[model samples]
Target chain A: MTKKRLTPPLTDADIENLEIGDQVLITGTIYTARDAAHKRLVELLDEGKELPVDLKGQIIYYVGPTPAKPGQVIGSAGPTTSYRMDPYAPKLLAIGLKAMIGKGSRSQEVKDAMKKYKGCYLAAVGGAAALIAKSIKKAEVIAYPELGPEAIRKLEVEDFPAIVVNDCKGGDLYEEGVKKYQK
Target chain B: MREISVEKITRTVRDLCIEAACDLPQDVENLLRQAKEREESQFGRYSLEKIIENVELARQDTVPMCQDTGLAVIFVEIGQDVYIAGGNLVDAINEGVRQGYTDGYLRKSVVEDPVFNRKNTGDNTPAVIHTEIVPGDKLKIMVLPKGAGSENMGALKMLKPADGLKGVKEFVLKTVAEAGGNPCPPIVVGVGIGGTMEKATLLAKKALARKAGEHHPDPKYKELELELLEKINKLGIGPQGFGGRVTALAVHIESYPTHIATLPVAVNLNCHAARHKEAIL
Candidate 1:
């Protein structure tokens, strides 16, 4: 598999050629949200109320990270399971939300949205939070402070590593990879 | 009777919580190494390497091993002759939980209400404590910080005696297969067979606290563990569900004598970072 470097505010061209199993190192700004934050974001959309941040062509990382100790930029930060966000992903992707970094599989609706919206799903190593935190250079809670760690935070990252799990072309590494190795 | 101070239990619980949260258990770590050596898929192998590296970073830096530090599940085995002095036992444990989550900077994932309010408790408190009275005067405390990732995927089933061993096996395999990558592969499958519904689930969870890679004392359950482990790895879920030959590191089954007609089975899964730390006072 080919390795590629990416920056956020991604365009269709930035992800169209990416296939499942391709390794990527993302550098730039990405937003953080978990199941709780996604619910609020979607609620705002349904009410026609503007969201706190523009999601267009941006990436969302599913994480709620441990509290950072003194002198640390962030604490252990890794991807949470992605399926819980499936109910809300199609709506976000419809609004130009680009890639998502998380672990586990997504629902069929999410896969369809990725295909239609020119977005892809990336999988970071689950439980590799401390290692993942090393790539995050800065973090701030831009919205929903009441949600505690579930609050929406903007993070600046450098070479944040992940692998393409689902792609715009409907390729799924989970399905293909399992079939290849199943005895 | 030996009198043990509440202060000592609190201090011990606090330290155990931090230790379990940050350090991947040594036995589980060794199993991952073996899994890595045998992995045929390049992606699976690469994923394993990163996990190994992350475990080291967290331990060396005294940081949480994962972002979801998880809820503290404490198992306390107190000797029948030991008298807990100075304070109520439950209160002392919660106090310890508050301190450990705070001092360790572990994430507070617990909610004040499961259905409503949904507010963070600020400090992780009221750990799920399971206490048993044992035969000796010593008190043993074990903390397993269980993450929601794997815990959410657990399942329980009640089968007729007719279903027997075959049905139980089918249900377990199905649970793990459907769980797939969600629980995080290279998982430990903890099975509880027999007992009532709640009892079975408790047994399943407690089974996870058992040291990884050790078989049940009974020969029948021990054989079942080995067979299930082989079947699970063959499913090709692999490391991170990327597909490989090492989907599960161990399968531990804890069983109890059952009623004549009912066989209840429960499954609890722990991610590759299967962590548990204990202290005996």
Candidate 2:
């Protein structure tokens, strides 16, 4: 059976070119949200409220950062686990969200959405907050500061490293890698 | 009976929490370097490198090792002869956590309620504290700053007494296998066997505080720990589950006697960055 390679999500090809095991430094815009922000985002879609930012071809990072130190753009910033946001992700993808960034596994429903919508999910190193924070040149909370760490922020990153856990072509590094190495 | 002051214990605990968050323990640091050398997969090697960099950055800059900085969880062993002077012991411990988090510039992740009105407490207060009474005059405190990434994957099950050793092994492997790369591969497996449900969970958490690579005193349990570690690595969960032979840095299991009819088991996964520090007062 012939399969079409899906359209890539980012303005830059680095994210698109990222292999399952290859490390790529990412730059450009990525949005941030956690459990609370995700709930509000889906609610906005239900009420048809205007989204704070247009997600078309945009990546969303699941992170809740510590407060920044003096002269720092942001505090220790690292990705949280992706599973908590799995339930709301496909809905966001259906409406044009292009990418998701976090650590750990995403649900099959979210992976299917990636295939259907031509989106991708990336995994950043889980506990490397300070190193990940260095990639963020700019950060501004776009919504829900009341949620503190869980607030949604827009980050401008440079050469941020991540693994392609799920790609638009339905390739999942987690399962494939496990199967390849399992004895 | 020996008398212990609440203020002294609280002050010591407060320092330990901050220290644990800012400085990756020496043993954990050495292990990461070792894991890097032992990692055959290129991605696994890369992950280990990044982890070492994170540790350096955290120590030099006084930033948290992880964004989660985790909920401040404490395990205390107090001698029956000791007394917490000047105030309630639990309250003092909570105050210590509040000051430690605030002064450390750590993220406040805890909320006032689990369900409605999940409002941030601002200071990361009201810590989850567990106290055990032992026969002695000393106080020992273990602080584990548990990240949500791995904690979300924790599980507990009640097996029939007949399930025995094989059942325990199966439950642990299944849990780790299901976790895949999500718990930040090269994870620490903490297994608690025997005891009631809550006791089992607490035991699993306490097991994590044992120095990495250390095993239980019982020969049977030590063998079980080694076996579980080998089986988990065989899952090929690898570092970050990208594919390698080093899925687990160590497997530490703690057990207690239980009712003849019950076999309660709890498994807690700790990410490679097992941020913990201890102090005795």
Best by DockQ: 1
Candidate 2: segments with Cα more than 4 A from true spot: A1-19, B1-3
Q: Residue-wise lDDT of candidate 2 within B1-281, one digit each (tens)?
A: 67778788778878887888889888777877888888777667778888899999999988888888888899888888787778888888888888888777789989899989689999888888888999888888889988878898889999999998999999999999988888887888899998999889988999989898889999999999999998998888788878888899889999999998999999999998887888877
lDDT of 1 by residue, B75-183 (tens): 9999999999999999999999999999999999999899987889988876899999999999999999999999999999999999999999999999999998999
The top-ranked prediction according to lDDT is 1
**Listed models, DockQ each:** 0.90, 0.74
- Candidate 1 chain B, which ten residues in sequence have the lowest lDDT sum? B117-126
Model 2 / residue B215 / CA error / Å: 1.0
- DockQ (model 1, Cα): 0.90
